[model samples]
Target: MKTAYQQFISREAKLADLPALVALEQACFNSDRLSKRSFKNWLQSTQRIFMVLEQGAEIVGYGLVIMRKGTRLARLYSLAISPTMRGLGLGKQLLIELEKQSVAVGKLFLRLEVEKTNQRAIGLYESMGYKVFGDYKNYYENNNDALRMQKAIRHYSNFSRLPTYPWYQQSTDFTCGPAALMMAMNSIAPKVTMDQKTELDLWREATTIFMMAGHGGCHPLGLALAAEKRGFSAKVFINQALPLFTAGVRSEHKKQTLELVEAQFAAQALQKNIQIETAEFELSVLQNALENGGRVVSLISTYRMDGYKVPHWVTITAMDQDCLYFHDPSVPDGHVMGFDCQHIPLAKEDFIKLSSYGKNKLRTALVLYPNFLNTSLD
Candidate 1:
């Protein structure tokens, strides 16, 4: 009997291989095997990483990685090895490749949920640097609990020796934008006060027409205006030319209203001498700005951290060559999604990927420079 394929090759999974994938899933998983339709859907999605380990004509193992559009996390959805090939190192090899693919797609961290009783699998994951963050009761269809594990794949050499900043939880779900803006403003200008009243007031001033499901999120221009109105000099950097939050609003009437509000904010920004640049800001530019007593409020997606299809704001406080430190506004009691939602350190590359919103990865930032009107990070 052929224990494993003599030759090993790894490549992306295609639709044609769906049958084999489904078969392998059935063979490996006693429960929770992905259906053929689900395999087909994942095979065609560019946002996910699906790969199969092949031994000439036979598929021996597979790995699946799912990347959230706006967050710094890449989840290892599944990993499997053939029963006949258990002794081989194919599982480890597949895991290493999955991590590589995850980082290449700009993910800073890797996470997975494993059955609590799967000792061998748990040992493998722990050996590969994953630490158990939490657990869920009755997570599996068979009523087995699952352990949540996470590992930071990227290692940065430089470190920023900066003071710890205050953490603020959003009073309401929709106030992440204002809460983050408040954190950034308070970081740069410590004398500025913040409260729930001010948070809602700022939300009223900076909000667009609609959010993922609520009233609206704060626009970059609107956020800049809000900061400027609070006596902080603000500069806006946006990657997309269109008005922000258009992707979240489906109704044409809402879109038009958002456009009008955006236009109004633009005019006000122009009158106030606030700068708006329609280009991606470089990491060096952000570093320079931070060095010059500037704080950055970035629009990010809550999918990775909160598992919600919504945009969020975060205050980028300090950075060095290796890591970018930020005061995250939406801190959950536990890991609601796959991430820690408080003040956190993210790898630079991952931060770049998470700083934008939507599929196009529209990068936007409100850079508030204190006591430096002439400073420019071009």
Candidate 2:
């Protein structure tokens, strides 16, 4: 069966192929070349995919992709083709196979850097649907600039193209409402500074002064007033006419105090032209607000996050067919990663269940509008 025809194959790099890999690296680029030691180490990393393309037992092309820990992103670290194999369409095969491997490993996006002067490589990447996101100055060993590019690996046609929302962690345990509000505001306008001082100021303006624990949580009306005072428009949605956060307070005096505070907030909202709807809006209505470029601050119980079952605040960032993505302001203990707090996804049914709190199932939401518009839900 032996003939003059040759066959090509693609497989993972092996440690024994170090010599050929180093030789290829040396022959490919004059600068920013991966060292022999780098190739050896990368070939052994469980977090990286180092692949080789072989033609008739000869390694003619290779590529490397690195998977970041605790993220849905993969990076194309390096790719090369033998000078003799150039223009043979083998490099495209290597890249496509690498992308397949990355998607197999649960990566949602792939990112890479190409030298600014490498027009051929840039054209290849762009042809493959990669987009240039940004650039770095003097990024290479030879002082050449690099163009940063990224591609969404998944078929996410139904995924919402969300606005850029800044994330903020609450400095205190009771400031989740303020932190969540700050994120929503900055999503509407980026000039709002994201700092601890601003977070505490928002908390001071919105706190209800009574809770089950040390500090009080922010009332929906107070939060709406806080947004209004800061040059933004908002609409408050309350599920019940009862005063919020009053069920947990054991004393009658504290209940009266929360009522008084709620009244003051309502008065201020009316004076400032903020809309307060004393009824729960449907999930579809919330979707309309976000689709119109509005941001929302929602109250949820932490029973699903931790076992505590305490009230918490999270900002609804984006949504798709199967999941709702939000930013939880409470970066709880043992879950310190920013990944744990930013754009956390939950099933739509589970999120709906998490949106209510307390024995009476108190539900509240604040929808923030970027400007004066038809915010009325028709």
Candidate 3:
């Protein structure tokens, strides 16, 4: 699609236009500029939406948005306007054009980051309905921070009908389970505190004592017990009754200790009225629970999201016809901050591949309900 303002028009960029695009990007930013090879790569990539604005056949502004492999969200990687083209509304026009391009490819949200000192750019984004969700310190080449921002590109979204999910970042690497649990609980009940004190407290409550290395991770039953103790209704789902993640530890004594801990967590869950289901979890069961006003904390393999080949925990808030949106407590690698972790819009097809972890493909999750039934998130 081409949008024109008299002689100023926007259209897709071609490979031959690489030099002009690179020149404009260099002229716009003093640091954190994209390499010429990067521009060429993006230009040739099928996942990239590259658009250039032209004034009387001269390239004046450009924007690039990239669609991820398995998700329904797009990232506005970069945008630039010629030095003389400032204040002509070219930036806004280019941004709008790029948003349309992203939506055309079935993306639900358009996310990006901008230098914090560039208030004009941030103002332009905010004025256009973008909201700042998180930030990254010392993100730019010159040590300037970047404010993470995004806008729901779709005019018709079903997210409003779902519960309001809060996002939290895990202070330490191993506390993802506790962090995800906190977000899920707070989403249903606002009284749930998310400070580091609560995070560490829950970790202390649920750790399995020995994992693949170092301190053990939180077991599914352990997480459920912690949630139930906090006055929320919880149901644990797992395929096998055998203790989960024993393969993570090689020591026979450590494995036995983990099994005993899991058994204790199981007994406590039963004593406290937390239900445990040992059947294989169908995706529809998880969706149905959410439809009936339940929050979920699930174990996922990070390989799909970042190739980490490790087990991680995340909270599931809601789902729409096209995508599954959740709050991940840990920020993914290769990112400046946890911006992309908040309300992440991943496709359902890919989520199935992500929700299971390790060999034997263990599937486990905890579905939770707030203390007071019918809690109004509105």
TM-score top scorer: 3
Per-model C-alpha lDDT, please?
A: 0.77, 0.79, 0.83
lDDT of 1 by residue, 80-145 (tens): 998998978788888888888788877777778899999999999998988785677988899999
lDDT, model 1, position 143: 98
Using all chains and alpha carbons, the TM-scores for the candidates as numbered come to 0.57, 0.60, 0.75
Q: Model 1 Cα displacement at 113 (Å)?
A: 24
Q: Name the 10 consecutive residues with the lowest summed lDDT in model 3.
A: 331-340
Give the distance in Å from residue 188's predicted Cα in candidate 2 to where it truly belongs: 1.5
Worst 10-residue lDDT window for candidate 2 reads: 332-341
Q: Mind giving the per-residue lDDT tens digits that candidate 3 earns over 11-127?
A: 899998898988888888888888899889888988789999998868999999876544677888888999897998889988888888788888888999999989999999999
Query: What ordering of candidates by TM-score runs from best to worst?
Result: 3, 2, 1
Worst 10 residues of 1 by lDDT: 334-343
Candidate 2 has a TM-score of 0.60
- For candidate 2, list the clashing residue pairs, or say none: none
Better of 1 and 3 by lDDT: 3
